[model samples]
Each structure stands twice: as C-alpha cells, then as structure tokens.
Target: MSEADGIVYSDVKFTRTKRNTRGTTSSEAEPTYSEVRILKTHPSTELPGSQQHPVSNGGSKVTPERVVIVVLSALLAAAVIALGFTSLDNMHTKQSFQTLRDELEAVKRNLTERHCEVKSYNTVQQTSPQPPVVKENDPCLKCERGWEQDGRQCYYFSIDLLTWSESRDKCRQKGGDLVQIDSRDEQTFLELKVREKMKNDGDMFWIGLTDSEKEGTWLWVNGSPLNERLTFWSASGPDNWAVYNPDGEDCVMMGKKAGAPDLKCWFDEFCKYTRRSICEKPAETGHFTLQCV
Candidate 1:
C-alpha cells in the first residue's frame, strides 16, 4: 500500500514444468519467475484530488455528538421523574388542606348554635325602675313558640310546679329569670292570666319578689329594690306569716281571688313552697339571634 498515489499492490506466484512428448512425467523442472504489478485505490483513504472520507473503527469509538446526546437524554429523563413526584406531592397537600378547612367550618357552626345565649342568660341586667315601655304593636318583636309577648318582653308561664329556687333555675335554663313585675300593667296582665289558668282557689304562681335578705326591705330577683308606688300585697297582707313552718314567709306568690281588686294578688309565702311560676326575657333585637332552649 502506497500513501502518495493511494494505490495498493500485491504479489502472487505460479510454478510450471515441461512435459515429454510421450506424455511421460519428467523429474527435473525449471521454475520461471515474473514480476507483476497491479494498481488499486484504497477504499478508506482519500485520493490526492478527491474529497476526503471519514474513517470507521467498526462502531467501537464514541464521538463528541453521541456523548452529548446520551448525556442530554439521561438529564431529560431525570427531570421528568422529578416533575412527576412534585406534582403528586402538591395534589396530596391540596387534599389535606381542604379536609382541614371543612372540619374547621363544622366546629364553628356547632359553637355558634350551642353558645348563642349562654352569656346573656348568666349576666343579670340591673336598671332603675321606670314606666313600662310597651311595644306590643311593634313589627320587629319576636318570641319563642310557647311564650307570651307583651311590649318588649316575652313571658313563659310554666306549668311544672317547683320551689322558688328551683323555679328560678328552670327559668335560667330557658334563658330567662323569674318574671319581674315592674308596673301596674304588668301586674294586671299576670293577675288576669293567672285567674284564667287557675285550677282551684289554692292555685298560684310565684313572682320574683323576695324579702329574705332583710325583715322588711324587699328586693326583686335582679337585686333591685321594690318600688314603693307599685305595691301589690294582698288585701289581707304579706304578714310574713310563719304559722306553717319556722322559716317565715320571705318569697311571694300571686293567686286569683274571686272578687279581688286589680293588682291585688301578690302574697308573701315560704320559699320552699312548690308552685307554678312565670319567666321573662327581653325580645331578641336586630343585632343578634338567640336560640332559646
């Protein structure tokens, strides 16, 4: 193989022997040698005046282009895997957040329903005595289903018989206190209502007035002094009667009389005596809604 002319030459030899006329083989033979030169161009090398061709190494060698492509492919596959994992994690996070939000909303609603009037029922409102502010004809007044609405007040006449303390407890459970007769009209309203519902002459309803703190100075359940002008003691008297038991008559009750004058129904009695009683609360205003139990 010559690089200058891009030719490849090879030598091959052949041997010949002279035969006798009678076709007998001769033992002595003379070998003749001849020089033969054949010119061929190499398939892989470039000729002097022709274009150059690429060399091949049986596909064993790696090129720069192939190395770059392999590296890029591996990087792309890794990126795709990472992206899939990130997307899955985000989906789980979103689902967890939504579940927590729903739980919070349910708890908030339950709190609102159960605690609507708890504070109002526990705290007593102290106010000076004044003329009754009636709103019986107002459009915004609202009350519970079984309660009677008068002016801005709702009254619940309980049928269950309980002691004075027990009756106040029951009223507090219903989001109210015992009825506070603040005016002549209120006393008259209660008198007429009790008269109609009386089962017999002994039937009566307990009022909120009490004189247990002192012998003579009476106070309402809300710690307010009884009004001197609004006295409704029975015609017979409060008397602080103690004939039945030793505790004396400290609590008051209102009973129906066959021909008693209006607002003349109140009587001082033993606090341990069980009787039907009345409860009273202000009507719900526009600011907040109260769910009475």
Candidate 2:
C-alpha cells in the first residue's frame, strides 16, 4: 500500500465468524468464516479549530485600531510643528516693532536737544553789546550862571526880573536870545524843564518869537519867522497897545502856570515880569560827518 493508504488502513480493522448444521451425515464437516471491523481515530498534533493554512505576516494585515492610532499620532505631530512656526513668527514681529519704537524715541530726543541749543545760541547773540554809531565832537560847553546847555544850544531860565527891553539886552550880552521851540518835542521838553525849575508863580517867560520890531511881523531871534499856526497863544492875545499898536505887536511870553495865557508886547518895557526863556542854534552837523569819516 501507498503511504497515504497505509495511514488510512492503520486506523480501520475488519473481523468474521462461521457456524455448521447437523444432519449432514457422513462426514459432516462444517466450515465457518468470522470477520471483525474496527475503527480507531488518531489525535492530531494541532489544537482543535486551529487554522489549516499558514497566514502571511505582511504589512497589509495591520489591524484597524493600530491604523487609527498611527494616523492620530501623525496629525498631532503636524499640529505641534505648525504651532512652533507661528510662535517664532510672533516673536520676530514683536522684536522688530520694539526696535522701531526705540529708534523713533532716539530721533525725537535728538531733535529736541538741537532745538534748545539753537534757541540758546540766538539768545546769546541778541544780548551781546553793540557799538554806538555817533561820534563825540566838541566837549559840551558849560553855560554861565542861570544858563544851561540843552543839546547844542544854551538855554537861560531867567531870574533877573527885568523889563522886556532889558531882558532882550541881557540875552544879547550872553550871545543868545529868547528861546525858540523848533519842534513840538523840543517845546514839550522845555516846558517840562521850566515848570520844574520855576521859583516865581505869577511870572511870564520870554520866548524867542516876537512881533515887536515890526507890526504883525513875528520873528525869532535866530531870524526865522514865527509860524502863525504853531503859535500857542490865548484867544485875542498879543493885543498890546490896542490903540497905538494897531499892528506892530511883537514878543511872546508864556504864563508860568498850566493853561496860562500868552502875552505879546511891542515894547521891551513889558518884559519885567518873570518868564522862562529858551535859546537855540543850528544843530551841529559836523559831528555826524566826522563819525562816518
């Protein structure tokens, strides 16, 4: 038998028995055959319900649970990488902004400092001393007693208490005459000075303007005519010798008090009243030229 048949026969057996009947005389020889069948089951080496075919161990045989876990782990790793990049970007942006802000602050501070420095320099420049433009000429002349030098002219505030004619003569003796106010500023200045220095109350002061030498012809001691519009005379003033002096009224005198009236007389005899006087000469022009030279 083949090896496969032998293995099968080894698990099975057959048995048989024979019986003889009497009455069959003469040599009743009865023959009987017996056969016996036996079945035997063998124990297999593998356990019950075990796989009949070998299973392959390839990567395709992975379990569902293991696949889900691997996918989740990969997703988690990607999330972490993205978060790291975002954090780095944020940090870089913050640093750049901080640097810009610091630079701006430094620029502002420098500008402020420069502005202050310029202002200080300008202030110093303004305060520095500058030279005078006018030159000194003849030393100021000293006026005689009762006379004072004002500007380039000598002025006398008379206290002599003399008649109009005597006053005129006195001014001539001093090489000057009654004062003439050439400008409003000069007039105001002289008025203030005279008021401050006056001693007599009811006295009248002689000014350079007069119509005395001729009727209605007012002239200054310096040979300049009085400007009728500029004369500070009370209404209807200079009406001296009303009948005999129809015109020839000359000589002007101002009252000592504020709002005092002006008086004009043809004769020097009326000058006895105390009055403030002013004298003037052409302003010295040589000094200005010498300064330029």
Candidate 3:
C-alpha cells in the first residue's frame, strides 16, 4: 500500500502463461505480472456495538444488559424480604389487640352476670306496717344500705382509716358527721356494734367532738357543748398522754378493750392521726330497715 495525490493506493502482482497451438503448456516460457491499486480506503479494525456494553469478572467481558438485570434482581429480592417481615409484624400486632379486646369483653360479661344476682335468698327489705311518723326524741325512721338503723338515725362505720378532718369530710359527704354521743344508751349500742365488727381485737376510731380550736372547751359537730354530766372515760382516761399530749390531743377517739365492753373506752388522740370513723345522720322516710349484714 502507498499514498499518492492525497489518496491511498494498493498494488497486486499476477503471472500468466501463453498457450501453444500444439496444445502444449509451458510455465517457464511466459510469465506476466500486474499491479492493482485500491482507490477507496478500507477499514482495518472492527466496529463497536450499540446493543451491548462490556463487563469483566477476571474471565471474559459480559454484557451490560445482563449486569443490570442481575442488580435489579438483587434489589427486588431485598425489597421482598423487607416487606415480608414488615407484614408479619403488623399481623402479630393485630392479633395481640384482638386478644385484648376479647379478654375485656369476657370480663364485662362476667361483671354483668354477677350484678344480676342478689346477695342471699333470705335478704329482703320489709316496709313498715305503715310509714312511721318521725319524732325528735324517740323518732321511728329507716336507714339505707350499708348503714345501721337505731331509732330515728342512720349510722355507718368506716373500714378504712382517715385523718380526723378527712373522716369528718367523708361523713359529711354521706350526709352525716362523726358520731356525737348524746346518751349512755347510744354509747352502749355503739360499743356493742364496735365489738361485733372487731371480732378478736380492738381498733381506734374518731368521733365528731374536738377541742382543737380551743383547748379543754370541747364541742360537737352541731356546735353543742360537751355533755360533761354524761361522759365515758377509762382509768386515767383523757390523760392526754400522747407525744404532744396537751397540745396535739385535740381530736376525740374510742378505743375498745378486749374485756371492757363499757363506754369508758374513750380517749383523746391527735387530730392528724389516721383512724376509722363513725358517721350518723337523721334517718329518712321509706329508707331501708337495718339488719345485720
């Protein structure tokens, strides 16, 4: 190949032998040589492809299309795995909530059924032969549920402890105040009830009377002066032997003795101490008749 006139030219040689009339061929007698030049330039290298790209893994080049497919497949697999776990977690949470709802429904059903049943077959309220006319001294009245009836009053004994003021507030909420003993009969009745409630031991409880505002000048919830004539005090009672006795022993309390079933169980206590309470209020008409529960 050569370059001439701003164009590339190629030369090719050829040999030819002359044929004899006698049908004899001689290669050594005649030989011919010819030169041919290519006018157009020819390609010497291969062309690149648009349909594919090369990828290598230390072996042979691979197609870019195949590599993309593999990457897409891996991503798809990871997405599928993540979705599977998320869906499973959601299902578990749904199941847990369903179980809780079922348990709550079951508890509600049990409570509804229990509320339908009464305490006992023999438990029944008896209306008086006629509505008893209430009076001031010896009134005939009725009590409410969880209260005891005595003459014209309704009394309630607390099972929990509260400070004297707290107990008074609670009693007032129930339409009463801590008990105020008016007579020895009332005191005896209260003592018997207390003994019945305490079974084996004695418990301290608060009353309405207090000397808190003014020392020694005790008063009742009705603002009545203490009935100094009719009183119950044990041996060395009202001694005010508390820690800050004379000053802190402002609230009145009742303490029972195992052997002493007397009204002399009264004592002075700190108004801040937590203790049971006795509440009393005037009975209402058509209220429940008191019975031992």
Global lDDT scores for all candidate models: 0.78, 0.56, 0.74
lDDT, candidate 1, 107-189, per-residue tens = 86555445444223223222312322434543344567798866568899989999999999999999999999998877877
Off by over 4 Å in 1: 1-139, 285-293
| lDDT top scorer | 1
Ranking by TM-score: 1, 3, 2
TM-score of each: 0.50, 0.40, 0.50
Model 1 lDDT, residue 14, Cα: 54
Winner by TM-score between candidate 2 and candidate 1 = 1
Who is ahead in lDDT, 1 or 2? 1
The CA lDDT at 240 in model 2 is 62
- What is the per-residue lDDT of model 2 for residues 1-293, given as tens digits with 9 covering 90 to 100? 34443233322233333333563435434444444444445668999888898777665767999999999999999999999999999999998998999899768645533432112334444564342233354332233445554545657777666655667777777666667776654565566666666665555567767666676687877788877766655555666644454443456766545544232221221433444454443333222221211
Encode model 3's per-residue lDDT on 99-164: one tens digit a residue: 999899768645543433222223433333443454453222356679996655779999878999
Regions of model 2 farther than 4 Å from truth = 1-146, 199-201, 241-249, 259-293
